[model samples]
Target: MVFEEGRIKQWLINYINPGMAFNDIKSVVTHYTALHPTKETYIFNDGTPMELVNLQGTIPVTYKSVVYNIPIIIWLMDTHPQHAPLCYVKPTPTMNIKVSKYVDQNGKIYLPYLHEWAQDKSELLGLVQVMIVTFSEQPPVFAKVKPKEALYHPSINNSFPNSVFMQQPPYPTHSPYPQPSYQGMMPQAAQSGYPPGGYPLYPTPYPAYPPQPSSMINTGTGTIKEEHIKESLLTAIEEKLMRRMKEEFQQNQAELDTLKRTQDELKQGSLKLQVVLERLEKEKSDLDKNITVLKDKEQELDKAIERLSNQESMDVDDAVITTAPLYKQLLNAFAEEAALEDAIYYMGEALRSGVIDLEVFLRQVRTLSRKQFMLRALMQKCRQKAGLTVV
Candidate 1:
């Protein structure tokens, strides 16, 4: 919206005094308008209207007599109800005032009086008119405030007072106590009994009237007065306390929700760890059973070798070997079994012949045999599963 004098003044007042009433300023004018044939007129205020000098033709109005020359003239146009008034200012020769010209270090014309003239009220008014013309040449700054229906519905135009168009209502003033209510549409004032718009005729119900003393006047009498306590401040404090409590409750609830989520995550992690531990224990048990079966096979092979050592010849009869197929089967089961036994026998003979240390040879033979036997058994299982018989 285009800035009006009233709006500008209000902004200035707000800048100067935050809470003071701006309407008390008598010199400040609003919606000021002037025309050419009438010269200059202060239509709204009771002050004397200023005289206007007509420039024979268009000329520029300068601060002093002149550094530059131009023309000034004013144009009049009818004002529309929904639109701001239209005016124009064209430059004229007579309006220009020439001053002593001076150039600084830079080649620029300097006119002291011309600068002062630009600030003059008459010159400012002319500038405002020029701005209006310039703006009209371009697009409108704002859409019309009134709707199209207002134009067709004549009653809508008169529904609100003219003051509503010029001035905005004061923002709802906050009060410590609840605003007093009346039976009908009109708002009731407080104990002051003054209605809106500065009217004081309305009667309002008083919530805390002073109590009368019972004692009457006798030959001599005394009067006593009681003080009434105001509860407005207390009410305001209570409202603030309630608001703070509500905010604290919401913060606490958010913390509780976050804690609950963290707890649920920890529970899920614990359950996953439990499942992993159970699977690891089962795998450890299966490995132990395989180790026990290997130990039993090794013990049976040791007994058979001891019996062969006691015989007069190293070879056993085929009939005697055939009577126990289990022994023969076990011997032929793993491909590396004969090599493992031969290594063990050679280590034992070397210790007996003093070629190696007895304790060292026995330890090496036991370790080598255990590892080779386990590996050979694994290889035999793989060969059998692939349908290849041992040679």
Candidate 2:
């Protein structure tokens, strides 16, 4: 059987997260199905029903040099890779599940690979490989013994028209009394110890009931004469009781194992929850501290804004007073530098208009330039002292 790509895509689309890409999922599904075609079905997970792609097939496992096809089912969740897929042994009716550390009595599989799943690393094929290797060491399932049907004598068999005594040849015997033979059956292959029909003969539950003459049968004297009949009946009853007790013991053992697993899982969940709670508490404490620091910073900002708003607009000279001595000195130097620059420019204009002689203009420009250099140097020193970068 082959899985249709379109159908697989459709199933993913319907169940996967809207923003999650399904390329990995599709690839894994297609690749696995190439070997074992899987069936897609809907199942409830933790009380929430979801449509998922699952494979129900036998995986080839080798045990003691013999290869066995171990039936299994693998479920891929919608949020696969981010989470581990569920796996279980799906035994046939004639097969009984074998419980081990990797596999539970209920047939659920648990593996280190699954527990350590990483979204970037884990995939369906890898999980299946792990299962194959684990099961090879100890097969997850074994065939059950087929029950034998009750045996009866040919005299009793002759009463039923559907009895095999009519068609099948009789088993060889070394009894003192001659054994009855069929008239038209194939010769018994005594050496082979099987009839020509190739069916193995089963030993009777008890020796043949003594041949009943019509007079003894009619008089009921021949009934229950063989003590072996009573012994066989008691033995069959005891065997049945033992079989039933064994089944009940197995069932109870499985339940106990299931409960133990559940307890371990619950303990793990509780530990995780406790860790998360502690982490949340730490985050909350940090947030509270941050809120207090923010409130203090906010108050400082509000006070600074209030102070600035209350001040009236003022000239640069008026605003520069009554501050640190270094700041005051720096502002005074800047003002003088500006005045000297303006004086030099106006002197040049006066000379160009012939309002002043070149000699006077040159002298004035030289003096202003010298004083401006001094002011600039002083400003740089004051800025450095104030821990500000010199511009």
Candidate 3:
């Protein structure tokens, strides 16, 4: 739970950047937490052995000179000094998209910055700023939004010709804006000579002129109408682009399916060929075994015929044959019983033959004592055969 002073100082440096603009987040700033888990049961939570920093903020992303505030959460993992943090875009529940390369239907976003994370020099604030700017290139295709109402500041889209007329004051207003009355009253005042509150010193009055039409202004600059046309044009272009993208996606999907089907067929053919190859190998082995059996049987038959032809001499060879069979049987029985020491002998043979690696033998020998394994003479013979050092 304790954080080293050096690590904590490095983390605190992420609060802001002197060179970059950091959009202030409304979420409450929280203290850092570190986890060191000794049990697998808490690996994802308390048992984590790294520092995890969680950041919640409205990431300011700009598109077409307009700014949008996208809410997101970032998780800096324990390997953060060496690993990139996890980022998630959190939109309102009702908003969802059907398709996007990075942002999911739930508005969770993925960016390329984390993919190329630099452990030695990477900082959290710098990373978030990069992500915010990257989103401008391809804003999320919203699943739902009002046609005119967007999450962007509306001032950029203002179509008024005279900006000064509609400029907002630095304070809030409680009522609707009053209509412009000066245009209508200007003509009336000129006709009455001088101003509405006439000064008494001026007895002379200008001759009354013909009254102009009382029709209100037209905002003759056509700024609002021009804006409507631009909006319509943009909508048309967007629709066309969407259709083209859909068409391309379907084509790619179809091609992928065809390739997948071909791959599956090739795999099936390969499996069949493998089965045929295995069957042929088994048959070849069986044929070789049968040939060996037939050769043995043929030798036995030849011997029997030979014995039949030499029946008269068979009695003369009986004394020699019986004595040889008794000695051979005694040797075979002894060999079988003495084979109990074969494992250690094989080890010695393998060591001498270089079949057992030196390092492996040395490691195993460290666990083995001479007295526990063999008689002193046998041990000496094995050691001599294996070229092992005296212990």
Candidate 4:
């Protein structure tokens, strides 16, 4: 939908003050003007007769011998003065704002002045004074120096209201008391410095409201009164900070304990794995030794069988020339006995040389002697029947 800029500009002229315009038809948010005809943004509403417009400005501030330019924004909702204007501080990109009692990390400034705002009694000048005072207590942290290009604005050089400049933070420590979070949905405000209260294109019919009085207005109030507010706000902030620190300490302690326990479990698991690995290595070595001994015994058995087969073939060839069948049989038996004797002699030699076990060879010797004696008796009987000389 098209907006009636001429009518809206005329309406802003009739309502706000003249000195707030700061010399041109426009004002800057971050060294840039919001006065362009296209910059006027509206929020569509189904119920309201008029739409709310977005207005932003850079409010110059000086604190602790340092000049800082902070941005303040406003949304002029239709249901205005009865509801407080949504006030926020948008620091430069190089600034790091703390989330404290008064200003949130999002740059939201919560002051009691909003609830006390009266349509006729309150002006944008008074609220700006509160913002300046609130921020003075706890200035934002600067990450780096702001760019020079952003600092070059005509509005930035313009002198701020003396009333805003005069207000101080609630403490001697350069900080304000921790105010509670903005309770709920915030309504918007019309700033005298911006279009609604003052715009250069349209002349102002109403003279400036001469600095309206606010509940937080710093009128000096004497030394005792200033000390009391500072002390109370300071005490409350200290208590809140202490509580937060304690909670963080407890959380860190819990995490450290959990990490220590995990480290201990890992150490135990590593020790158990080492023990199991050592045992497996030892068992493997023993099996290797046993396998070597068995292989040596197999080699000895193969040699013994080869020797026995060679002796049998030699005896059979000698017996083939004999004519008596009985004598041939006797001779074959005697050769078998001789082969057994040779086997016993080799086994004894192996045992003495430590190639074979002594007790194991002794057991085999008794078993072989019985077989040798039986073959000797059979050879003698065959020799007697054939009447062959026993050689």
Candidate 5:
């Protein structure tokens, strides 16, 4: 008896989705039917009992009780000839007609066969007419009774009832039914028509009393009328309405206050966001300036490298013409230099291996010495530009 509204809503959602196939519908119906048994008759708005009758169909369905013939319509929607054929007991001949196709202004197409046959008035018109005719022909029966009057009264004497009085009740010859006892004189007055042990054949009719005046007069005073109470009731109702209006106004004011608070919060949030965005823009400008400075420094370093390369090329030409003894001395000096120690050692090994001539080896040594001098000068210039003393 306690239906879960949420569960039914979920079922409806599943049913209406276009993606749900026939099998899904069948399963959903089966589950619903299991929860709601068929033995119980579901009454429709028209007071008709619905019995579930499963018609033979491609889709396996068990007929549950139908209420207001709704199950028949449901079965038709499930399995029609165009989609899936459904067979039912006592199938009407008029139901064989194919349903009409209806399309909405939205261009949504609904095949007549897709809808229930009962839903189509044109299709079920004759059937409904036939049903109405049959029902009218055999109307339900109701009981009727007429009031009887007492014509002649009969008397019964218990004292002489054995032979003389037993032939019949003494002459006025009323029915032999016993009379009911009266409240004040029960044993003597039995004219009320109910017997001692038997129930009354007819209920006693109540005597009608004359209506009283609407206004009542107080002792030696003016009359008090219902109008006073009516006026008071109306006044109370007006006061209640005024109170309700005041309460509604208060509620409206509270709602407006809440809305104003929300608006204030939103405005504050927007202002904060604007402030953050401005700060971000400033940071972005600063980063762009830093990037430009780094690019300039890179350009300066490239020019310095080009100058050192040209100077080294000139130094190598001069060293090639110099004496070999002077070259050897320069080599020993280059080996002792901390910065060029690794270069000197590798060059010495190459010369010893006969990979290069003495002239080429002397030139390379001179080029390396000039490059080291240029690098040291560049480092000192960089330190001076940065306002740092070179050690």
Candidate 6:
């Protein structure tokens, strides 16, 4: 697919915030796309689907002074900078994956750079560089061996599509020791399984081993020594033991990683509990202080109640005693006015029941009203003299 740089930028600008994160993404995308174009898609993992930008291409790696191209795919998640990108070794059909400590059986690449990815420090470009360097030390894939005829016959090897060769690397690139080629059968060098111009140029470092004589194959049992058989058995046992040890080591490493993550979670939980405990302690202290204050206030109220209960009630005359003569006269006048009002009210009730003569009742009411009015006037005068408010 043609790489649409504009479309990719537009998508990023629309989705990512315009900040350090955006700039970091733009810089990496721009730099990487110079060598290879990008592809966009929505990808789903164990989690929810996300729109991702992926670069599927080869990066150059120099191994033993010979430059080789390693085919790989880098997936940039939507939450870039915050999280590291996913890297995978993309091998062709003829290429079988070579698993190492850095590259898993699934062709998923793992690196210290990826594991320790920091938003402030890490970049996508650096990650690609790391992958290149790591793969150069140990290539992640090797070309699958063809049939003996294809390997030995030049004409048969050339019959395969050149385009297929262009995509895949040559056979047995994972072997630390040099591969033994048959120069006697095929003279001219061509794509073992890879391209002519070296999409990944894997040159054989050692010359082909001489073919074994037919006479040796017929006398194999006679030539085979007891020591050689024992040695072969020991070598096989050692290899099996080594393989089992490696598997156990990988499993233990995974468990250790899980334990580390669990430890971190426990640390966070402990901090939260500490904070809660501190807040609870503060609340408890405040409650204790409040209880002390309430107890003190309760003691004061009880003392006031006890004092009032123990004291004798004052006599009416002593309670109503005034310091000034005008206050005393006002008090006496008020009492007389209230008594006369009651007497007048009772006389009116008696007249209504025909118990008193109308003439006597009217005379008594008139006298009582005159006396009440005089007493009220005297009370007002006395209050005014005493500097009190009169109603």
Question: Best candidate, TM-score-wise?
Answer: 6
List candidate 4 stretches off by more than 4 Å. Answer: 1-7, 10-51, 144-391
Q: How far is candidate 3 from the true structure (C-alpha RMSD, Å)?
A: 24.2
The per-prediction tally of clashing pairs is: 28, 0, 1, 5, 9, 0
The sequence of per-residue lDDT tens digits that candidate 6 reaches over residues 1-391 is: 3455567676566344425444554565566643443434433433334445556566676666766556676666666767776777766555666655666555667677876677889987788878778877877766554555334543223444323322321121122111222111111124223354223332322122112111111132434345654565576466556655765676689789999999999999999999999999999999999999999999999999999799898676776668877777888899899999999999999999999999999999999999999999998888888878978
In candidate 1, how many Å is residue 210 off?
36
Model 6, position 270, has a per-residue lDDT of 100
- For 1-391, candidate 1 gives per-residue lDDT tens digits of 1324454344333233312212211111122222112112212123323222111122222222221212222211111111122122221111111111121111112222222232113232433334334333321111122434333433234444332222211112222212211111111235224455322231222122111111221112222122211233354456556645654675687689899999999999999999999999999999999999999999999999998789776445443453354444554545366677778888888999999997799689879878886867766765565556854
Model 1 misplacement above 4 A? 1-231, 312-391
Cα RMSDs of all predictions? 29.3, 17.2, 24.2, 25.4, 26.5, 15.1
TM-score per candidate, chains pooled: 0.25, 0.37, 0.30, 0.30, 0.26, 0.41
> What local lDDT score does residue 390 receive in model 2, on the 0 to 100 scale?
92
Better of 4 and 6 by lDDT: 6
For candidate 4, write residues 239-299 as lDDT tens digits. Answer: 6676556546756876899999999999999999999999999999999999999999999
| lDDT for predicted candidate 2 compared with the true structure | 0.59
TM-score of 6: 0.41
RMSD of 2: 17.2
lDDT of 3: 0.45
lDDT of 2 by residue, 227-334 (tens): 544554565466556655655676688789999999999999999999999999999999999999999999999999999899887687555554698888988898
**Number of the candidate with higher lDDT, 1 or 6:** 6
**Preferred candidate (TM-score higher): 2 or 5:** 2
RMSD value for candidate 1: 29.3
lDDT of each: 0.37, 0.59, 0.45, 0.53, 0.37, 0.61
